[model samples]
Target: MFVSELMSTRLITVELDDKLSAVKEIFESVNIHHLLVIESKMVFGVVSDRDLYKALSPNIGTRTETSKDTATLNKRVHQIASRRPIVLPVSATIEEAIYIFNTHNISCIPIVDHEMEPIGIITTRSILKALDEKKITLLATCKTQ
Candidate 1:
């Protein structure tokens, strides 16, 4: 199967100049794990939920929160994003994605167009979900036979 077949088309993109607070808000309100960082309509980096967590102070929103802790939110996405990320074409196969995941430390791969603009995203979670669905289908087929 092609990566495009299983990729999540709903993308949440942020700019280099954008603040971490806005990214935090989006993550808190959604069920996503990664956000693409774009520039001039081209994808250049990625910021995962873990990255945001590490960049922010643990005391945020707590009674012990200080002005300095709040200042961390003012940091730009580029400051914490993984730059020059590895990307795959939408036409790439699922096996290729699996290979990349196994060899790289990254959690997700951005699916891009010819111009390097992100069209979709594929994560380890997506691959696992696809595998689970395929397993269920195979089990059903065997039972029918």
Candidate 2:
């Protein structure tokens, strides 16, 4: 199946200039693990709960200054977020999505349209659910046969 068949259409996003405090609030309020960073409706990068907390933590050794003069404790997401994000087109097949996820060691991928505009997000959980459902269907078909 195509990614659009299993991807979540309801997306929660944040902008690069948005305050870390606000991102934290959204993370708590929505109970979501990750948020897509967007700019001009285009996918920028992903920010996870861990990334936010790491930024907020007062640990000295972890902090790195950004171009905006803000300190990031978790430099990984912060640095990546400063650049254009890697995005997958919504028309991509599940197998292709799996390949990207496996090869990149990324837990999530933003689904974009032909114009590279953000549309939705595909996560490991979503893929697992689709696989589980397919397994169940196969088992049922085998029993019937």
Candidate 3:
């Protein structure tokens, strides 16, 4: 199978200059875990929920919140994003994505075009889900034969 087949095209993006506060709002309001950071309409980096958690103070949004804690929100998306991400082309195979996941510590691989513009994203969960569905389909086909 190709990466494009299993990848998610519903991209949630943030610019390099976007604040962590904005990213926080997006994460809270949306079901997404990763946000693609773009520059000049090209994929620049990736920021995950875990990165935000680690960058921000735990005191944020609490009664004990301090100015120092809230200051973290003022940080830009570029500050915490994983730069120069390992990307894949649409034609890349699922095995290639798996190899990247295994060899790197990244959770998602942005699928880009020839210009390095992101078109989709593939995550470990997506791959596993696709594999499970394929297994079920195969079983069903075998039983019907």
Candidate 4:
């Protein structure tokens, strides 16, 4: 399978200047794991939920340091987002995508066009779903044999 076939076109994006508080809100509201950071309609970086958690204070549940957390949230998205991500061409194979995922320690890859414009996002979950489908096919083939 190719990445373009599996990549998700429905994306949630944020500008580099957007606040971390806004990012937190989007993650909380959408149950999404990553947000693409775009500038001038071109992808600049990617911010994962882990990145948000790492950047924020751990005393978030204590309420006492809520102010600290809020201050952290006031940071710009570009400050927290990882820049120069490993992007995949829309034609990249699933094997290539998985290799990049495993080798790069990245959970997501922003699929891009020739112009470096993001067309979609591919995640570990998407790869897993494809694997599951292949597993089902293999199991059925074994049963028939």
Candidate 5:
């Protein structure tokens, strides 16, 4: 399967000056685990939920919204986001994605166009879901065949 076939087209992105507080809100609103940090129509870094948790003192999800939490969240996303991320083209195969996941300690990868414009994202969950669906389809076909 191709990455484009299963990658999510809906993207959540933040600029350098964007706040972690805003990121927290999006994280809570969506079931996503990663956000692409973009600048000038190009991806600069990636900010995972784990990264956000480590940057916050008490973690934003907790009800303990202390002044420190507010202050820390107000920090620019660029400050807490992991920079210089490796990206994949939408034409890449799913096996390539699995290879990347195995070689790197990353759970999410950003999908971009040839011009480096962000188009979609692929996560471990998406890959698993696709694999399971494909298996089910194949099994059903085998039963009929």
Candidate 6:
């Protein structure tokens, strides 16, 4: 099947300049693991929850805020975002998507169109779900055999 068939249309994204704390809040609020970093409605990169945690590490560098207030501090997403993310066109086959994911060691990939506009997201979870459904169908056939 094609990526467009199983990709998620309700994409969660973050701007390049958005603060790290804000990204963290969105991560927690939505219970999502990653966010697509977009610029001008185009895919720029991706930011994961792990990236935020690393950026907030005390030993990384300067501590922008003291113990009192941390949420107000600013940490640009671009500074920690993963650039040159593994992106695929919405028409890519599931096998192609899996290859990209395995090659790059990524769990998700952003789907873009010819214009490079963000269209949807394809994740390992979606692939696994598809596999599970296929397995169920196969099992049903076995039972009837």
TM-score order of candidates, top first: 1, 3, 4, 5, 6, 2
Candidate 6 on 1-145: residue-level lDDT in tens? 6888888988889898999878878887886777999998889999988788877745333566464345333779989999878899987987788778878878889999887788999888888888787832543564599
Query: In candidate 2, what are the lDDT values of residues 3-56, reduced to their tens digit?
Result: 888889889987777777677678879966778987788787888777677666
Q: Write the per-residue lDDT of candidate 4 for residues 56-121, one digit (tens) a residue.
A: 887765758777666887888989999989999999987788789889889999999999899999
lDDT ranking, high to low: 1, 3, 4, 5, 6, 2
Q: Summing lDDT over every window of 10 consecutive residues in candidate 2, give the lowest-scoring window.
A: 73-82
Reference-based TM-score, model 3: 0.91
Query: Which candidate leads the pack in TM-score?
Result: 1
TM-score of 4: 0.87
Candidate 6 RMSD to the real structure: 5.1
Question: Residue 43's C-alpha lDDT in candidate 1?
Answer: 93
- Per-model root-mean-square deviation over C-alphas: 3.7, 5.9, 3.8, 3.5, 4.0, 5.1
Q: Candidate 4 local accuracy as lDDT?
A: 0.87
Mark the regions of model 3 whose C-alpha exceeds 4 Å error after superposition. Answer: 135-145
Q: How far does residue 74 in candidate 2 sit from its true spot (Å)?
A: 14
lDDT of each: 0.93, 0.73, 0.92, 0.87, 0.85, 0.81
- Please give the distance, in angstroms, between residue 43's alpha carbon in candidate 5 and its true position after superposition: 0.9
TM-score of each: 0.92, 0.74, 0.91, 0.87, 0.85, 0.80
* Span of ten consecutive residues with least summed lDDT in model 4: 134-143
Candidate 3 lDDT, 101-136, residue by residue in tens? 999998999999999999999999898787677732
Clashes of 1: 0
